[model samples]
Target: MRCDRIEDLLPAYADSALDPRERAEVEVHLASCPACTSLLACLRAADEALAVFPEVDPGTELRGRLVSIAAPRQKFSLFTLLRKPSLQPVLTAASVLGVVASLYLLNPGRRDFEKNVVRTFHRGVGRVEKLYAQAGGITGSIGSFAENLYASLRSSNPLERDKD
Candidate 1:
């Protein structure tokens, strides 16, 4: 193996993680290349130093906080869905649909029902449009009023009046 390839495998060789064939190749390269040998020595020294460092236990409060952070979170499930009050509207809609399906299966008057639903949806959209228009008109009037007030103030200022 080349010096570069042996250098790349030095850390794994130090950790005893390399395969026997690769380790032998790296050993041969390291013996022939002083640079690769030094690099391997550095990696081994780092590993040994790390191994000798004493493990420190965290404080009780920090341990508690870490345990809380690392604890398995509550996963979303059907029971979680049932627990959420915000899902009441969804549940109600689902139940209503179930009832409608049963009724349609029995009576088969879904065309009229679909038409009514579409009409109601269109009415809601129209109301939303009217609200947006009203909001736009109000904003336009407020903006115009602010502009007029600013112009009048500018005109009434003694400095501005002198300039004019």
Candidate 2:
């Protein structure tokens, strides 16, 4: 291991916090590196110096403030409910069903609903067929009118007569 890595492990080694494998590695490095051994000695000296001071309990207000800062902040909103991963499929299915029900008027409970739908569909198709027949008739009338107009113009035209 490098000197820098061994330096980082020195504090944990001093506190007896490192696992056996890590402790072995650190020990092996310490045996070879003079700088790391000296750093470990300094860390131990600092720990011994800090041990003399008595620990003090924090005031209630300060403890409460610390707890408030550490605790997660939650904001309530409709968008938050909509954004949940678990609710996505349910919301999507509900909206899809809403659209389908609105468009198709699906009524499974009523026994005659299917028959009514079929009847309405047939009526709509029949209206479409009637409109198409009317359009075809009007197109035929227009064609005949155009042909008659051409014939009348040809009969009255001197240029057309000369050509004949």
lDDT of 1 by residue, 65-115 (tens): 999999999888999878799989999999999998788877767788789
In terms of TM-score, the best-performing candidate is 2
* Candidate 2's TM-score: 0.39
Q: What is the C-alpha RMSD of each candidate to the true structure, in Å?
A: 27.0, 16.4
Off by over 4 Å in 2: 1-109
The superposed Cα distance between candidate 2 and the true structure at residue 117, in angstroms, equals 1.0
TM-score of each: 0.36, 0.39
Per-residue lDDT for 81 in model 1?
A: 79
Q: How many backbone clashes does candidate 2 have?
A: 0
lDDT of 2 by residue, 1-164 (tens): 99988888888899899999999999999898888888889898989988887878888999999999999888798999899999999999999999988766654555587778899999999999999999999999999999999999998999998898
